[model samples]
Target: MSAQLIYDLVPLGSTLVYTDGSPRPPERHRKKLAVWETRNSGGRLIRKQAEARVGNTVLPASITLHKGDYGNQGTIVLRVHQTFSVNSDLKFAVKERPAIGSVLVLARPGDDAELVHLAANRADAEEWLTRHGYPRAVFREITADTVAADAVEGRAAA
Candidate 1:
């Protein structure tokens, strides 16, 4: 699917995998394998930015994925995020979506809000919010109706 489809249909916090449609290189070709790895990997959808204009320049809409986190003993040291424009050449697929009854912890309330976390329930979401400080964060619960609509519309990973 195109990145635009992902931005439009796939819900935030869903697991996504993007590929350049190339076969994996043999391990012996370390350099080639390393390059291939960059073009093929999975991550959690986190943020989406709409098209914006800065002076005379126009920036295309984009989506950000949380690729990985590096840490030790509960301390996060590094976070890797990959942002892809709507016109990205790579193909993308939704690997998983937040299940019904799960709660989405969004950083803010709007189309551009980022998914900060996904909690099991309202109580869990409240507990998590107490621990993390996102003053303007909004919580959205996935409902059965939402799942039904997506399933009927063929929003599942393709």
Candidate 2:
């Protein structure tokens, strides 16, 4: 089985309102960011994008997904930082069965980047990814392979 993740919603950062359009001038910066999640008719997670309330500020695009079924309904939380430049710094990394059971969490500084990650087994991998500010694209690619390998291992262990 491949590595899969179910992520819980986590607030990225704070948003401040700015009246001026100066990216350099911190005074003109607005903290409010646009947060939205895209899902299909089946309620499956699609993608998440966050943009600043003022100016053309856009946060780093990332994917936060939950692999488990939610009472027969599926949902995932998507969020972006309050600043645009901050989005560009997003990245992703994954390691399977770290010290036993599956878990995902952001392995970086700053609690805002930290997210709780749970696999099919309610692992912490998803959480780790959120804390690290990883891009959604990388999450999909790496998790897919990791989960696949995990399945084989799990079956053998069972």
Q: How many clashes does each candidate structure show, in the order listed?
A: 0, 43
TM-score for candidate 1, please give it.
0.91
Residue 117 of model 1: what lDDT?
Answer: 86
Off by over 4 Å in 2: 1-38, 41-51, 54-63, 66-104, 114-158
Model 1 residue 130 lDDT score: 99
For residue 28, model 2's alpha carbon misses the true position, in angstroms, by: 53
Q: Model 2, poorest ten-residue lDDT window?
A: 34-43
- TM-score, per-candidate, Cα-based: 0.91, 0.17
Per-residue lDDT tens digits for candidate 1, residues 1-158, read: 88988877777878999999999999899999999988899899999899999999999999999999899999889999999999999999988888999999999999889988899998999999999999999998988775555543555435
Give the winner by lDDT: 1
